[model samples]
Target: MAKLDVELKVNGEDYKLQVGSQERLLDTIREQLKLTGTKEGCSVGECGACTVIVDDQAVNSCMVLTAQVDGSKIITVEGLESKSGLHPLQKAFIEKQAVQCGFCTPGMLMSALALLNTNPEPSKEEIKTALEGNLCRCTGYQQIIDAVEMAAEEWGG
Candidate 1:
């Protein structure tokens, strides 16, 4: 396969990489850019474990080809923290014990981040809808929803 030249802005950093045309976005982010924060659950896109924010929308990385997202801005779980402190959602997740096994965390965080970015004060139903694509075998969704609610409060949503 021929390698294609591409540039992606991820987590506020720009990267120029040579990617194959058949490369999935998940593999490109994880293997090429070394953003291991994006997990790979079901490559078929049913699990939502490879979720990332592309231009403020939560999308399954496995569902997109790296070539399809040229020049796009992406945000993975690694981007959630800053020098000041952990993001409000991260704090809430830790306090509420919403993470388990840790495989689903990155995707969950990305989905939640997208939700908050769009609707800071999302109702329970909205939260549920936002995370419907993400599957977490551990940590029942109640705690996750609670954590999102708490973050909304902290972020003044």
Candidate 2:
């Protein structure tokens, strides 16, 4: 297989490398960049555990080929935090106790981030819509919803 050269800006860092045709963006982010916060749940894209922000939109990393997003900007769960402190959403999640089992939190966060980025003040229904793709077996979704609301209120865009 021929390795295709790709460029990506991830979490404020730039990267240029050669990727195999079969390499998915999820593997490139995890294995090549060593950002493991993006989890692989269902490879078929049913589970949103591998969600990430590609060019400011939330997408299932498992479904995207590395070569498909060669020049895109990507943000994973690890990109949410900074040297100052946790992102408002992360703080809200902790305060609302939205994390349970911790399997889907990364995807949930990415989805929520994308929503918040576009809609600073999203209605509960909108929040639900944004998160519908992400499946969380724990927390009953109420806490997660509450966390998103809280983050929106606190961040105020």
Candidate 3:
């Protein structure tokens, strides 16, 4: 297989990488970029544990080929924080105690961020729709929903 050179802007940083045709975006984000926040639960797209924001849309990183995203902008769970402090969603997640086993938090955050980026004032149903692909075995999703609501209240302005 020939390695294709691709450029990606991830977490506000630019990276030029040579990726294999078979490499998934999740593997590139995790192995090449060294951003471990994006977790791979199921190699298939059933579990949203591998979700990430690509070009401001929530997508299953495992389902996308790295070469398919050349020149794309991506935001992972690592991208949620800043030098000043945690992103509003991150703080809300912590405050709401929406995390357990910690495997699904990153994908959930990215999905919520995608929704919030477009619709800052998403209703409960909207939030649920954005996160329907993600599956969390703990917290029963109420806290996660609450976290997004809390963040919307803060960051929605």
Candidate 4:
């Protein structure tokens, strides 16, 4: 099989990579770029564990081909932190104790980040709708919703 060249700006960094034709964006981000914060739970996109921001939209990395998103900007869970510190969403998650078992936190954060980036002050229903794609077995989702609400407050203020 031939490889396809792709250019992606991920987590504020640019990368030029040659990837397999069948390679998923999740694999490229995890293997080539070494960004493991994006998890692969259900490869068919049913589970949002591999959620990431691509071109300002929240998408399941497992569902996208690296070649499909050539020249796009992407943000994974690792991108949430900066020189200043953890993002407000991250801090809110911790403060609200939204993490448990830790498997779904990355996807949750990414989804929430995508929402907050666009909405900044989403209502509870909007937050629920934004996060509906993501699944969490722990924390009961109430905390996650609360965390998103808290982040929205902090983000708006």
Candidate 5:
């Protein structure tokens, strides 16, 4: 297979790499970039566990080809924190006990961040809609919703 060279920014860092034409963004993120924060649940874009922010839009890493993201900017769960502290959503999730088993936390955070980027003051229903793609096997989702809402309030959204 011919390797394609691509450049992209991830979590505010620039990177240049040679990727296989068939490489999925999920694989590049996990294997190459070592950003395991984006989970791979359903590879076909159903579970939303592989969600990441590309150009400020939430996307399923599994559904995107690495070459398709050349020159794009992506934000993963790993990028949510800063030198000051954890992102508001992360803090809220901890406070609300929204994480269970930890599998869905990354995707949930990505979706919530994307929601805030666009609709900072999302209503409960809007929050639910934004997270519809993500599936949490634990907590039944109320805590996640509460976490996002709390984060929104904390961010003055």
Candidate 6:
């Protein structure tokens, strides 16, 4: 196997790395970039635990090859917050008590972020559709939905 040189912009930072052909974006983010905020629940794409934003769209990091996303801008859970303060989504998640166990929170947040980025005022059904891929065993999704709604009210900037 040969290593491919690639450049990726993640969390507003650009990185040039040598990646194997078989390396998944999830591995690149978690291992090479050390952004463990994107968890790997199932290597398969069924579990949204490895979700991240690639080129403004929410995608499963486990489903994409690192080489496939070369030169792409990606956003992980870490990217949602900044030095100024927590992103509105983060604040809403905490305020609404949307996190439990936290295994699925990162993916859920990423999905919600993608949706809100495109549609600041998404309907409840829209929120559900955006989060359809992410599975959460806790919270029953009501709090998460509420959190997204709350973030929409606070954000939209």
TM-score of each: 0.97, 0.97, 0.97, 0.97, 0.97, 0.96
Q: Model 1 over residues 36-95: C-alpha lDDT tens digits?
A: 989999889888899999999999999999889999999999999999989999999999
How many Å off is the CA of 24 in candidate 6? Answer: 0.1
Lowest-sum lDDT 10-residue window in model 5: 135-144
Those runs of model 5 whose alpha carbons end farther than 4 Å from true positions after fitting are none
Candidate 3: pairs in clash = none
Regions of model 6 farther than 4 Å from truth: none
Candidate 4: 10-residue stretch with minimal lDDT: 131-140
Candidate 5's C-alpha lDDT?
A: 0.94
Per-residue lDDT of 1-157 in model 6, one digit per residue for the tens?
5799999999899999999999999999999989999999888988798999999999999999999999999999999888899999999999999998999999999999999999999988999999999988775599999999999888963
Ten-residue stretch with the least lDDT total in model 1: 137-146
Clash pairs (backbone) in predicted model 6: none
- Candidates' lDDT values, in order? 0.92, 0.95, 0.94, 0.93, 0.94, 0.93
The segments of candidate 4 whose C-alpha lies over 4 angstroms from its true place after superposition are: none
- Model 3 TM-score is 0.97
Worst 10 residues of 6 by lDDT: 132-141
Residues 1-157, model 3: lDDT tens digits: 5699999999889999999989999999999988999999988998799999999999999999999999999999998889999999999999998987889999999999999999989999999999999999875699999999999999995
Q: Least accurate stretch of 10 residues (summed lDDT) in model 3?
A: 133-142
- List model 2 lDDT by residue over 3-69, tens digit each: 9999999999999988999999999999999999999998989889999999999999999999999
Ranked by lDDT, the better of candidates 1 and 4 is 4
Which of the numbered candidates is closest to the native, going by highest lDDT? 2
Give the lowest summed-lDDT range of ten residues in model 2: 132-141
